[model samples]
Target: MHENEISQIVFDSGLKIHRNLGPGLLESAYEECLFYELSKTGLLIEKQKAMPLVYENVRLDIGYRLDLMVERKVIIDVKSCESLNDVHLAQVLTYLKLSGCRLGLLINFNTKLFKNGYKRILNGDVAL
Candidate 1:
């Protein structure tokens, strides 16, 4: 599936999860729920997938992990915090770069409104 299509499904799943379980939950809780919801759609998803970093032609297992990688095309960074900061955005962007994916979704489940908590991040200078 395309990244945008997968993203739409993710948004819908996130909304359903947020509505059913409101906020104040842990990130792992939301991630598990989201993973279950997405799994039902028959899409391939990797949870807590470890990522290796390469520096100066040397590969290092720096313990970077993606929260969820959907279909190997999009990365989903699950967050349940007071608010998403620049670090979160940078984290997703870094994942996209490392995975060579074009799109990423940063879903923060600790908000009064679900829509306000999600952000679509592009890998490069491409418009959203």
Candidate 2:
């Protein structure tokens, strides 16, 4: 599926999860549940995947991990903060740049409504 189509599925799943369980839970809770939900849909998703960063010609393991990668194309960053900050956006964008991902979904599960927290980040710097 294209990133747009995959995003609809992921967005629906996130909405369902948020509806089933209100805010205030740990970010990890939402992550695992969302991961399970996504996995059940048969989408390719990697949870807590540790990916190395390469600079120039050296690969470094600096503990940067992707919260979830869907279809190995879109990067999903799960969060439960009161609201998403610049750091969240930067983090996901950085992931997309480093991983060569074209799209990213920054899903924050701390708002009363899922629509209030969904963000689609595109890696315009890297040609898709």
Candidate 3:
């Protein structure tokens, strides 16, 4: 499937998780719940995926992990913070770049409405 299609599936799954779980939960709770929802939708999802950072031709086990990778095409970062901030959006973009994925979703499960907390980030100059 195309990246856009994968993104839509992830978004829908996130919405379901948000609707069911509502707000005021730890990020890990939302992460696991979203992962479960995505799996129910028949999409291959990976959680807490180990990501490596290469430096000087040497791979370092820096303990970096992706919150969620959907279909291995889009990255999803789950957040249960009080509010979505610039750092959160930037972090998602950085993850997309590092993972070589074209798109990412920053889903903050701290708002009353899910729409207000979902932000899409695309790689490089690409627009989503």
Selected candidate, larger TM-score, 1 vs 3? 1
In candidate 1, how many Å is residue 106 off? 0.5
lDDT of 2 by residue, 19-78 (tens): 999888999999999899999999899999887899988999999999999999989999
Q: Which candidate number has the best TM-score?
A: 1
Which portions of model 3 show Cα errors greater than 4 Å? none
lDDT by residue for model 1 over 1-128, one digit each (tens)? 77899999999999999999999999999999999999999999999999898889998998999999999998999999999999999999999888889999999999999999999999999664
Best by lDDT: 1
**TM-score of each predicted structure versus truth:** 0.96, 0.95, 0.93
Query: Least lDDT summed over 10 consecutive residues: which range in candidate 3?
Result: 6-15
Taking the candidates one at a time, how many backbone clashes does each contain?
0, 0, 0
lDDT winner between candidates 2 and 3: 2
Candidate order (lDDT): 1, 2, 3
Cand. 2 Cα-lDDT: 0.91
Output the lDDT of residue 117, model 1: 100
Model 3 lDDT on a 0 to 1 scale: 0.87
**lDDT tens per residue, model 3, 24-83:** 999999998888888887878899999887779998888889999988899999899888
Ranking, TM-score, top scorer first: 1, 2, 3
